[model samples]
Target: MNYTLRTALQGLWHDKWLNLLCTLTIATSLFLVSLASVAYINIKTISAKLPDRFSITVFLNEDLEEERIKAIISQVQKHKSVKKLKYISREQGLADLRLSLGDADYVLEGIEGNPLPPSLEIGVTRRAVSGDGVGRLVRD
Candidate 1:
């Protein structure tokens, strides 16, 4: 058995290039498989988190009256799928935009009045994370 092992080692030493190629091939395959597995896990994690971040923002017409805006908010709040509802006035929207823009708020200096319209931000509940549930809520 020892003689056979010595012969095998001698053969490998004589064909060093072939042994190196085989070793490199095995290493490369393992590296690629590991990389693919990591990517698959990351994708699954991101997709699972997508539902929690799902939301619906309804942009109301600028001419909509205060009463109509309140009515819309009330209606949206009554929906079973709605986990939370928030009303963003034109002023609030402008403020938020300014904050987001940081120093770029100067770009809006030439604009006359807040052109931004009021909007309703609705958060969907965990139970309503399904595609159909979100679609039904939007349709209704």
Candidate 2:
């Protein structure tokens, strides 16, 4: 084993530049790929384990009045498993979109006005995010 190690080291030193370059390149690529994979797994685990982080957004008819939106939210809030609800007004939604767009002037320029209306953003309690529970809320 010592002889073999000595011979391998001598051969590596013969092409030091090429060996070093290949070793560093492989190491860097492996590090980046491993890091990305770890980050992806962490993100997936986070999303899967915490279902309550997602909001169940129900969009009503565009012509629907704000009063109906409020009433729907009130009904949803009555549910024992509902954590919170948000009614996003059209203007507020538009502002959110603009903020997300980062001043991309042409992003919504073609759109004349805010088409999105006040919708119910319902946050389910931790235990109420099962498939059946979500289905019940959707059916309501």
Candidate 3:
């Protein structure tokens, strides 16, 4: 074993530059593989969280009666994937827009009236964000 070790060491010493190059190549490959794995994991995590951010906004006609709006709300609620529902009145939407605009709210002041429409903001389950679930919801 000692003789084998001595021979191996001699061979490595004789080809020191080649050994170093091989070592560096192997290390670089491993590092790249590790980086790719980390990137893939991070992408998967972000994609999973994407469903939580999914939402649908349904704008109602300005002249729709309260009863029709209620019916629309009921219909949306009947979907199994519906997780949360919020109704935003025209005034509330304008307020929210102003809040979001901050100092830029001056841009909205030129408008004579609230141009935003009343709408329903609907949050859905993760399953609803994938495949044909969203399509079905929109169709209904």
Candidate 4:
């Protein structure tokens, strides 16, 4: 026991720098692991708070009549993947564009009269956001 203790102490003293380096490496590795774990947890929490619904925009023909638009809306509503939907008229689209452009909207004014087409905004359920489901939605 005495010899073993003496040998152990001598080894530690002789390899003090190496031991310190190894200790620091382990501590740094542990710290990095802990930081990654915390980052992963935080990212998971933030993602969980986001809505599960995915949005899709469908632009309608510029000359579509109100009745035709209604028919299209009815057709889209039949899809099982769609959780919610909203229709935006061309004027509304233009107004939204103007709002987004701020003062630069004057550039659009000289181009044409209501050049934007009406559109439908759909919110797909999380389960339907898969590739196959999205493909089906696109096909229909």
User: Judged by TM-score, which candidate is best?
Assistant: 1
lDDT by residue (1-140, candidate 3, tens digit) is 99999999999999999999999999999999999999999999998889999998989999999999999899999989899999999999999999999999899877998898899999999889966988888887
Candidate number with greatest lDDT: 3
Better candidate by TM-score, 2 or 3? 3
Model 3 / residue 83 / CA error / Å = 1.4
Worst 10 residues of 1 by lDDT: 48-57
> Where does candidate 4 stray beyond 4 Å?
1-19, 42-53, 102-110
Shift of residue 101 alpha carbon in model 4, Å? 3.4
For 1-140, candidate 1 gives per-residue lDDT tens digits of 99999999999999999999999999999999999999999999998888788888889999998898888888888899998898998999999999999988889999998899988889898878888998989888
lDDT of 4 by residue, 23-78 (tens): 99999999999999999999998786554746889998887888999999999999
TM-score, cand. 4: 0.72
**Model 1 stretches astray by more than 4 angstroms:** 63-65, 126-132
TM-score of each: 0.85, 0.61, 0.83, 0.72
* Residues forming the 10-long window of minimal summed lDDT in candidate 4: 46-55
- Structure candidate 3, residue pairs in collision: none
lDDT of 2 by residue, 1-140 (tens): 99999999999989999999999999999999999999999999998878858678777677877677677778888988789988887788778878888859577888887777666678988777788888877777
Better of 1 and 3 by TM-score: 1
Give lDDT for model 4: 0.89
CA lDDT scores, all candidates in order: 0.91, 0.83, 0.93, 0.89
